[model samples]
Target chain A: MTAWKEIDQHVKVWMNYARKLILAQIKTDVQVSTKSGPNDLVTNVDKEIEEYYVKQIKLFFPNSLILGEEGHKDSGMLKHQGYFWVIDPIDGTMNFVKEQENFASMIAIYYNGKPLLGYIYDVMKDKLFWGGPACQAVYCNNEKLNSPANLSLKDGLFGASCPMVLRNYRGINEVISKSSGARIVGSAGIEFINVMSGKLCAYLSFLRPWDYLPGKILAETLGLIVKTIDGEPVNVLSSTDVLVATDNAQSEIFKIINNY
Target chain B: MTAWKEIDQHVKVWMNYARKLILAQIKTDVQVSTKSGPNDLVTNVDKEIEEYYVKQIKLFFPNSLILGEEGHKDSGMLKHQGYFWVIDPIDGTMNFVKEQENFASMIAIYYNGKPLLGYIYDVMKDKLFWGGPACQAVYCNNEKLNSPANLSLKDGLFGASCPMVLRNYRGINEVISKSSGARIVGSAGIEFINVMSGKLCAYLSFLRPWDYLPGKILAETLGLIVKTIDGEPVNVLSSTDVLVATDNAQSEIFKIINNY
Candidate 1:
């Protein structure tokens, strides 16, 4: 196998192992605590999963840079000219604690600032959607996903952030009105999966690097659009409002956002 | 077995059969069309499922009055003193056509204006959550579900209607802000499942009789509150805004709506 193929194999194995750990933790009393606020929660499982990923990365590729949600941040690592991995130990921590479903674990790897492999695992469902530009096709497990039809905003469901929808931020209300309906799964990764699987036309939310990177990589590779509400490239380092959408939907949304 | 038990067994078998029919239709070319507007979608599969349910109900209970989402509407059936069946063969028709995952099939049986049983089957997930006050316990598949802890609005996720959240109607914005966060699944049956399964503390939406009745029956059996935004009892014969919530969350949400 080629170098990328080998890396893919190793990462897949690590993800499955991590899934086991996360599932095991749920069976026990999960140690939960507040972070920035009461709603912003972090559990012992999140930390353990992140630490597990960091340890594996260090052992396999010592020179690699890691940016993880639960710590393990190498500032300015996006500029690093080597293996760089972005990990969200558990996306939608609230959903994990509350629903125990609709949450995901994601990892995005970049080689010398270029997209490599991207993986987002719906841990409970045991469905791993992973691929990148290198593979030339995204796969939900072994079946490669076809590029979704370029559905317009009016033709598909639009995923929105609850706060954005509530506040009508950036003409989101107008955008939602144009779509068939709005859905909020409260997990960026799962929402991204919805779009990637041709289930949703677009997904918009304020997201961090680790939250958006894996989905962004997989989405863009499938001929989807990932950018800011203003139609600008998203900075990999900053937390900002991001929109990942189908081509036709992106154009339709831009019309609404620009009017706002 | 008791009369209710026999009915439950037969209903479970019918639901599994309907699930098979629906899944089979998805594998073929689904016939889709609009109702009311382009956003309000219905499919041949939806009609077929409803027809199947009606046939089963009529065969088993010949005197039953059926109120179904597709076509079978026995007017003023809620006042009927015999078996009254409410069938939403496919709830979340939009989701069924667009996502094929989040939608559900629901059947609510009432006898002499009293709820006897409710069944909501998440078709794709193959999970059947069915029960009533008659059963004294709701069961997801074979496992009995406990009544969720009465979480306050600040302690759990709240499910909201897109339009309500968008317009901030009825002070939904204030109610959502008080909750840990907001979620919109676009399927009343599924949202009710979330609440029934202790995943969401509350779910609010504007729904017709078929849209809300099954969930209402099931949710009330679990000691959850189901009422209008004004804290009034929900009528079984009309379309209105409904709220199904945990006891504590119901009180908290009523305070927000009252203040509004």
Candidate 2:
């Protein structure tokens, strides 16, 4: 595997650049429109930011396959390649357009479909979480990161979508309710960061590929599980109920989700 | 009545000072302890910010009664006081502590228990929603804000306690389903801003006095309904299931809530 230290440096450059563009492009008189429903939103800022990140990827690493929200790129599928970057230029766009905070710019680099680097920047706060390369995965703002404990769901908090709490989703409610508790931050990148830092034992949300990839790379590198809620291995090219967690958390969570 | 221009100056001066002290006190490693439950968190930042605002209030207007979160306040219930201030120095403390974002600073000032001035500041975005004292009140940042349409419950979105979306919570689910959709921003001040701005037709949440006062002032100023789900007027010093909405939205919401 390539040294994550070198890759993190390169990814940070692109992440920070997109962060600047995103902030600059955010309109006070934002053009707000519903996506799936009213809860889900896509502002011009979201689409523009995603496009900006895709542009940067093609310029810096022309051969790198790009996967992004807003259909900014079409990597088609994960392939053994020199480099592939997954980007969610503005994760939590509703929060960005409405509240204007708690959103992030996320990107991940994969070398031959294995983790090489990951970065999720809290644009407003100027803090970034990044790492990959499982043997010595890291997570932080240009600081060292320790791999989280292999905690079970019962031992820690979980971050997830609201449907899971209402038992509207499959085995999620049972699996999640049995945990210490749940925290829904409404962004995959933030939830993914929570799992990597041990703030959360697991995060289960119906997320698109761009939303899941950066976090998935970061989670897997931190020795955490990144799988579907049904315990199926994730299909990287499509959206899924992605569950990212520590190994012990995954096993314990699987028990609760097994009914599905 | 004092002009909004005059009131804005005073409210903003004090808020900026409070925000500065708050900014200095809060950081990633601040001491955090649980409150109410594991899900609820309180940091030293909360206490310090409220105290600073209290001190500023004493210096600026000695006669104004003051009510503040963090238990540092000493003022009676909303009465026919000549001048008074209600402050939630740091709203969304859970988000502030865990996510370190999405929290806000809020204040509602009144003369004789009538809405005189209101403010809800998204600290990260540095945008303040402020206005009051009128046959009709309005909100804005440095510029003027045009009120969004008084859409019905079936037409606009709602923000509320996630619990309201499920288990009926007084038929909130049906009321919400009638709406285009729902969003849970996890901050009363922010949620209330959405309601006042008409981005959401209604907001219902379990709230303490501190959470209600500022939003209550703003919602009422916008020709909207502000009350408990049971149709009781919110007591300025009580815990309640507070609801804020336009008149039409309120009617629709209450009817459904009554049925459930």
Candidate closest to the true structure, highest DockQ: 1
lDDT of candidate 1 over B1-260, digit per residue (tens) = 13899899889999999998988888576999998899888999899889998999899888889999998888768678788999999999998889988899999999888999999999999999999977888999999999989998888999989888878888889989889999988899999999987789999999999999999998999999999988999999689999999999999899888988
Worst 10 residues of 2 chain B by lDDT: B160-169
* Model 1 stretches with alpha carbons more than 4 Å out: none
Docking quality level of the chain pair in candidate 2: incorrect
lDDT of 2 by residue, A74-175 (tens): 644466467887877789875676445668888777777776777788887787987666435565785888888888777676776755554457766566
Candidate 2 chain A weakest lDDT stretch, 10 residues: A72-81
Clashing pairs in 2: none
Candidate 1 per-residue C-alpha lDDT over A104-186 given as tens digits, one digit per residue, 9 for 90 to 100: 99999998888888999999999999999878889999999998999989998999998888788988999999898899999
TM-scores for all candidates: the values are 0.98, 0.76
lDDT of each: 0.91, 0.74
Cα deviation at A134, candidate 1, in Å, is 2.2
